[model samples]
Target: MLSSWLLVACGPSQEPPENSSLTLLHPNNPSSDTETYQTENDFDLLVSDYESTQRVIWQKPDLVIAQLGDLSGKTVADIGAGTGYFAFRLVPRAERVIAIDIDQRFINFMDSIKVRLPENVQDRFETRLGKPEDPLLKPSEADVVMLVNTYCFLENRIQYLKTLATGMKNEGELLIIDFKKNNLPVGPPTELKVSTAQVKAELEQAGFKVKKTDNQSLDYQYIIVATLQKPTNKIN
Candidate 1:
């Protein structure tokens, strides 16, 4: 057993709605950011859904893919994969894409969409309900682990990073794309934004070595490619 502290950003209670498919959860992952975000009811109306047009301009998904290097025959875990925004892009390139979200609603939404997608696309992707602390993925199973705009919201992020590496292969990479600390036209509140240097320092403390960083790849955010400083060093 990893830990019982898994949870969403502002997650569901220990027991989700009686009708919910989410039976594996504990509490919300605590964070120091004081800003507020969406709720369960908000998701029902697709409030969490990303805007494709804006994403094309701001996130530049295509550029992000190019930066990731080769994905052929790779296994990627898209942590906090809201509505499988990036997972859809990964499934076509990677051998497998495991979409994990603490919100079961997101997983269910992905399931609904997955059913309508082509069989080949469906075969390349999977959805798993995750806890805030644990991604619930097998040990050393992924070649690439990614998080897009998901880092600032996690509680005990340092601990989560320590736990996150367990799911990556010895030489695997961890990619994070998040909002910059500066004020932006579109993004989370300023207080919630985390600087790239801050993330780098935190990851370094958690036993990850920052390999590359690109500030211009995304309009309002930055990307970091880090490799696990392997040899199986676990943080106490």
Candidate 2:
């Protein structure tokens, strides 16, 4: 079992009202809930609202997809896939896409939307109910696992990465996209924001090698591509 101590970052807690559309779930403290600024029952609503308001501040999905190069026939996992937006995009590019989220409500929402997806791409997308600390993907299964705008909510960063690593095949890649701490007002609370260096350090400590880091069009976020390095041979 992975240790809980590996989780890092903490934030204020607030109870979400029954009718509240948005709820923030933190991985470090699973029992606590936080109310978000917006209220939207469906993840698509949140995505659409963000895109509309932050058109200049949001990263272009197509550009990000381009950075990933050729993914055809590759199995990818979208961790913390709140609305399956990224997963849907990956469906046509990747051989398979496992969209995982911790919230049952969100999973239900994904399932509901899955019905409307084109028949040809529908078979490539799969949904899974996941936990904050564990993504629930099978060991050595995915060629790539992506955490987009969602890594800050995690408490046990190392454990979470380890769990993800377990599900990744050798040489698998992990792509992380999150807001930069200095780019205030664009993401969560300032204190809860994570810097690229911080993310790189945490991932490195979790046994991943930083392959590339690039600034994203989003006002204060970056995209990092990291890969697990093979162990070096040791002298007997």
Candidate 3:
């Protein structure tokens, strides 16, 4: 389920407090996008939308997670991890799970859930407040990066992917799952979505080689798996 948060592309309002260093990325506040989450009621509404039980029928989270293959000791970065719907599930599977979002409320919400998890699982999950222009992942810090129902809202995606690539290993994998450009019963408006073909082209421009694509698995979304292509005639 989409969190319906189209984070406006803007700089942070102010620097994070010096003592605040819990986020995996540089802490930054989202712009005044009151429409996204103006009040506690609004936040609660969005949370319910994202964590809806009916979502399981279409999202098929377990099948989606299996597409990443083994995760015994891998690190996964879940971009736009609204309410940790997918991030928390990755905690026990991946060695490290970075749940990232631009919205502070979502981060706080996920952190609340984190505290309730078992001690071992809690240690594996980390919430990150990211910037609109960058996810702020560390150099080669992620073995796999996933964006579910979160790609279409981005601005200047090619440039964003270039920045994201620097944070992934030389041959790290990137998995993107988003709504298809069709009038589906669920998901955002078709006009606001990105097609699988467009995603493949963008991945190529961003230096990733499309490895696999699954359009039939999910009812409303398409899956794309690409690997960061190593530089040719260039040193790492």
On the 0 to 100 scale, the lDDT of residue 208 in model 2 is: 97
lDDT of 1 by residue, 1-236 (tens): 11011122223223233433221111243431222122224343232225233346557788887777899999999998887878988888899999999988788889998999899889989999998889988998888999987888787889899898888888789999987888665555577668999999989988899999889867678999999867856799
Write down the lDDT that model 2 would get.
0.71
Of candidate 1, the 10-residue stretch with the lowest lDDT total is: 1-10
**Winner by lDDT between candidate 3 and candidate 1:** 3
Candidate 3 residue lDDT tens string, 44-79: 545655676666767899999999999989999999
Which has the higher TM-score value, candidate number 2 or candidate number 3?
3
Query: How well does each candidate superpose onto the true structure, as a TM-score?
Result: 0.80, 0.78, 0.82
Q: How many backbone clashes does candidate 3 have?
A: 0
The best-first sequence of candidates by lDDT reads 3, 1, 2
Best-fitting candidate, measured by TM-score?
Answer: 3
| TM-score, prediction 1 | 0.80
Which is the winner by TM-score between candidate 1 and candidate 2?
A: 1
Ranking by TM-score: 3, 1, 2
Question: What C-alpha lDDT do the candidate models reach, one value each?
Answer: 0.73, 0.71, 0.78
Better of 2 and 3 by lDDT: 3
As a TM-score, model 2 comes out at 0.78
